[model samples]
Target: MRTSWSPAALDAALENVHRAGMPGLFAEVREGDRVWRGAAGVADTATGRPVTADMRHRVGSVTKTFTAAAVLRQVESGRIDLDAPIGRYLPELVPGERGDAITVRMLVNHTSGLAEYLPYAYPSLKAFPDLANTGPQSLEDHRFTRFDPVELIGMGVTAPAVGTPGGTPGVYSNTNYLLLGRLLERVTGTTAEECITRDVIERAGLRDTGFPTGPYVEGPHSLLYEAWFGMIDPPRDHSVQDMSWVGPTASLISTVADLNRFYGMLLAGEIVGPSSLAQMRRTVPVVSQEGKLIDYGLGLYPMEAPPGRDVFWGHGGTVWGGGTLAAIRADGKRRMAVAVNMQRWNRLDSAGRPRARPLDDALAAFHRVAMYG
Candidate 1:
């Protein structure tokens, strides 16, 4: 332990993020046997409902970690091969040379060179590839839309490859995870949600974490507000929107405590075997959806760390108005899981790049104290 676990310091850090324009947020920080949970701001601006640490939240692509863990469980059972091409399991979905060229490991690590399907599926969000463009119109247009995973896979597969398979600086794409979802179904003869829930979520005993059954998040939760970088003037509440568009990739709803628990067990070799965990810790360069190169592993990535600070392994995810980050120190002792009700704060520059904001530094400082202290 650091010999200095300050609950007041952690609370102040969480408060700083809220002061930096976060609508609402909650977090859980653990140090050895001690645990601290905190929340700040309002859950609903209209109603002024205060946020709480126990609220369930739409945890975005953090679902990838659970999905990757499920795949590794299958690997342990001899039902799947990590190095084998995805085509072997879902040929009809990822056919021919492209499928043969991309392996399960590549897909898990985001090195498969698949272009993101978001720009294709939500054409309005084309502003994504070109950050200077504004397109929150499609967000509301498809709020209730239920997209088929196979159709989304087609959009990404048919799109031009971002790079060669097994290449460095891999582009992060939800399409690769969508295919992994289908592969899970093809092998387990069940929905990807069911397989992951049974194999990883249930195995880890995450009571507040599971795939959303529909447009509504069950149990108590905060209203999610999306800023869209000022595209939507006042920001809009997307708390009840359907999440099928991201499905097994980013649709899981959970809480801060559950997230911390999941990572703790995951790092302790309780959720996956030692070999599988080692493979997950193996890092490679991959371009994150945010357009920055990050050290990504199989469904996991190290949160950005300052020089001389200990590295933390986990994942961060965002969907519309919500975002969550769950990370555990490499030594598996310190951990922090945070969920925010607001997202997309940075204003785009002339070249479509997001300008740095005080909020960014505020959040980073919070992570530093939460994980290291």
Candidate 2:
């Protein structure tokens, strides 16, 4: 049931998250014409600079939604076919029979069976499918490294297939999205970043969202801290890093307000035509990078809610240290976007599984109040 929400409730929840472990947190929540924004804790732990409700964040993976929309826009223009094999367009990248087997639709929904290149790209993380015990060496080494998308794609493509083409329970991989970015560039005859910025970000009228052109965020932003499941005792800051490793797949910088606005426009059918939006919302079961089953669409996913609560649709993103989540209610009447400064709080168990920490519960509590109220 929908209940009345006081500003105090939201503020308290946010503070709870900070007190739990986050170095900083900021969020925006809108219900109908009423909007609430809250911030708690510091943007810089060393200086104790306060975080604000409006600040740029490296919202990893959320870039996929924009990329997916751009491709769907191409679909609207009849320049691309959803069911067409990717090999048909970029055969040189995904050559041979394997390319013919993976469809654009499969890539969008992550059913293409491509393994994540993260392990291969960051050799220190090769110990996966269990990342809980992984060290931070690879991330540290590549902080300033500029990775070519093709080289990264090759790592994932040549890696053993995690699943079959068009398979169910598909594995979540950044490789699929990197390939999508290439597809966008192939069809648009321009950079993927430019196409998304012009077609999706600008079209949504989001002033604070864009692909980062440099190693640093240009505006007011918090320092992103990475804990690496407590491997780094003080949680090293990773706010300034060359984002080329993920490229168009996870390197977009944005704010909570911009995220809310972008998702609101997207769900309202203002960014893409209704047919394209429909295709973007078609979900398939996929194993997330977190090792949980999620209903993933093109670039969007359904936020699991209680039986009686309204379902929210959008996406969650995490870079090395920063994390973000933005969603609009299924009815498009309510929306929430949240950003946090620290990541990898869960401790690893003997089995190499992540054990939930207090911060996880605290963040969920804030989300319940932010989105459901």
Candidate 3:
């Protein structure tokens, strides 16, 4: 049975998130024709503008879902084969036997065993033992720099593989999606941005979601603050930066409402066909550095709901200075989209692993309200 959303409870939860350290938060909950929106804290610290549900924010790696969908669309059209090795499409770029062994499916499921390039590309974090926990200081010099996807993939391919392609547990790598983006272009003979826009965004009727060609977000949006654990300074405004560094993988901007609609339609089999959707939901156990097991599919993550709540399927994304969480119940009866205009919520321990902080509690509270309230 589905429960009606309690606006009062949701409002209180948003307030707690603001008090817990987020500069601002905007969220939407939808069940059939009924929708509820809420916000708290200041969108701009200088002017103290309140965040609104319609405000656009960077959705980060959630862009992968769209990319995956575009690829699947090509597969359905017979332009691309899921099991074919990526080297078949981009042999010049993804050379060697390892490339030949890695299939399109492996890339989407993060089983390609590719190393991420960000840590090695940035000079500041070169000595940081764990690149996964690299902080904002590492990116300060290149925040506005434009990066070519080919160059990014070159850096990653030069690094050692995490494991044998398709033979080991998935290790999350931004490089895999970067390559996938290139593969999409190779197969479609169109830019990744154009393909995603037409195939996913337009098809889903998401008016507020887009791939920005420049650093500025071109609509009402919250100021993104990065608290890099005092590495550069706390609550530094990083709302604008050239996102080309993570192109096609983590560079899409969207609003809570649009995100909810996208996920709702996606899980309902509106975006991709039944066969492709089933392939997307096929799960593999991915063990994180913290030793937690997460079930990851093609581009989606299946998050088990709290006790007594229905399981939700979707994705969560975090960029330099913002975060997004979008999910819908398996039955498609309930959906939620939440965006926080702050990043690096958890403090890094001496080993460079994230440890719990106030922001974690705020996120948990927001999820509880969105999923179970």
Question: Pairing residues by index, what is the TM-score of model 1?
Answer: 0.98
Stretches of model 1 off by over 4 angstroms after superposition = 1-3, 127-129
lDDT of 3 by residue, 252-323 (tens): 999999999998889889999989999999988765433466888999988877677678898888777888
Query: Candidate 1, after superposition: displacement of residue 328 in Å?
Result: 0.2
> Candidate 1 on 284-316: residue-level lDDT in tens?
999887778899999999887777877889999
What are the runs in model 2 whose C-alpha is more than 4 Å off?
Answer: 1-3
Of 1 and 3, the candidate ahead on lDDT is 1
Q: Write the per-residue lDDT of candidate 2 for residues 10-72, one digit (tens) a residue.
A: 999999999998989999998878889999999999999999999899999888899999989
- Alpha-carbon RMSD, candidate 3: 1.9
As a whole number from 0 to 100, the lDDT of residue 64 in candidate 2 is: 89
* Deviation from native of the Cα of residue 159 in model 2, angstroms: 0.4
- All candidates: TM-score: 0.98, 0.98, 0.95
Return the clash pairs for model 3, or none.
Answer: none
